[model samples]
Target: MDFGQIINLSLGYIFSPVTIAYALAAVGLAVHFGYAGLLNFGMAGFMAIGAYGYAISILSFGLPWWVGILIGCVGAMIFAFILGIPTLRLRADYLAIVTIAAAEIVRLLFTTQVFDEYTNSADGLGGYHAGFRGANPFPPGTYGFGPFTYSADQLWVRVFGLVLLGIAVYLVWALMRSPWGRVLKGIREDEDAVRSLGKNIFAYKMQALMIGGVFGALGGVVFALPSAVVPAVYQTSLTFFIWTILLLGGAATVFGPVVGAVIFWVLMAFLDAFLPALAAVGVLPITSIQAATLRFILVGVALMLIVIFRPQGIFGNKRELTFVK
Candidate 1:
């Protein structure tokens, strides 16, 4: 069954750009559902805003790559403000509904013909890598060992993604340790009690939303680093995947997202490689394509098991499982 190839393929994802992107997005989700008790189902919307915002700024507006990143972050923050305003005071389920719908709206906007000049409509945007790649300092050469090897450009993207992930982890860790973070937790636990203490629950929720959105946006930027910006990439399924990663790693813990991302992607990569090989060897009663589809079903089953048996996740405290409330 070529287990060696499967193992190599799976191990390669341990530090892949896609893993980093999911980690960043999951961390943002952790901020929303884990710490703030926000049921944000539109995280994919924030990611789309970030990716399209960065691509459009550079491709259409002729902005620098750094400027495009700033625009993306700002765009996600604006989206957060828009989403949080009317919904923050409402039930958590309302935020979930609005976010999921808002994300689809964002994806469709990019797919529409009206903004084809900027977004390239359904074809998506590419050829914007020149500016970002120009800033690479690694020189022209291959790096790393075994399945982890990469050319100069790939190495540049992975290094950049890791740096951003590190900064995000530090930021979330630091913020969650402060008084403001304590208030966020308090809001999550009992907003009415916090409000009784004269704290502005709405403001805190809004701030958490914005912060998490910005993180999601940064994740989008990283996501686009290695590939083109496609509307299909930011669909509702992406948010669910991020949620799976967040819940798998222990949502309230600082390093949970990163750890969870690594584990999830590695397992996915392994299954992606192994399942097809098994099909070729007639080990499974399915075609290679059908075997490939089974991984998704496995993911769904895994998520259900986590929610039912280990809702706190690997790193989350049992007491911090406040999403049920």
Candidate 2:
């Protein structure tokens, strides 16, 4: 086994756009479920809307890159408001069910042939990155050391994605430390109590939903920056993966998603790179496909162990969790 290659592959995910995107999505999940106790199971819907909104604006309306991003954020907010208005009034599980179903609805809509003119249906859209790439400051060259390097485009993506993630972390930290955040936490513990205190619980929940969803949208935008906006990326599993990242790092903590994203993706990269190769070389007892499936099994087992023991997660406060009640 090439230990050096293993290390490079692992660290590569540490700075990849995919990991940054998941970290952002996990942060949004933290806001929805951890702070406000809203079970949003359609985070992929937000991402899909964000990605499609940005891509469509650029490709159809000839909008500027910044304008496209604005469209993406606004589109996601409108989607969340529309989705939340009816569903937020119900039980958390209701929202979860609706959201997950809604996500599938969104994905199917993207795959539908009716909207092929704009959506491109299954083929999706590409070459939308030209405007984004025009904004790149890199001078067209590779940047990195040894095998652990990225092209100018890749480095630009990482830098921009990280900046967005940092801003998200700061904003969430500030919001959670304020009076507004307190009310959200209170609502999480007991909605009746929060309602009794004369706060607009529904409005706050809506705002939380929209705000958290914008993060997911932004994540989706960044996620597609290095790739194309394919319909397949907006599946339910993407939402679950973000949730896993949130749980692994601690749902309520400010930096949990960032650390969790890095760790989860790095571990996945390591496992994906080494285990299969080992198995192929007859040093391990699994096939290549089994190795791939086993990574997911490992993630599940890890989650189970965490829930069985430290359900609060690595950086989470046990006090913040109301599961006992």
Candidate 1 deviant stretches above 4 angstroms: none
Please give the distance, in angstroms, between residue 314's alpha carbon in candidate 2 and its true position after superposition.
1.0
Query: What is the alpha-carbon lDDT for the whole of candidate 2?
Result: 0.89
lDDT of 1 by residue, 131-202 (tens): 999999998998989999999999999999999899999999999999999999999898899999999999
lDDT (tens digit, per residue) of candidate 2 on 20-128: 9999888988999889999889999999988898899999889998788879889889989999889999987788999999889999998999999999999998889
- Which pairs, if any, clash in model 1? none
Model 2 misplacement above 4 A: none
Clashing pairs in 2: none
Report the alpha-carbon TM-score of model 2 versus the true structure: 0.97
Strongest candidate by lDDT: 1
Q: Output the lDDT of residue 103, model 1.
A: 94
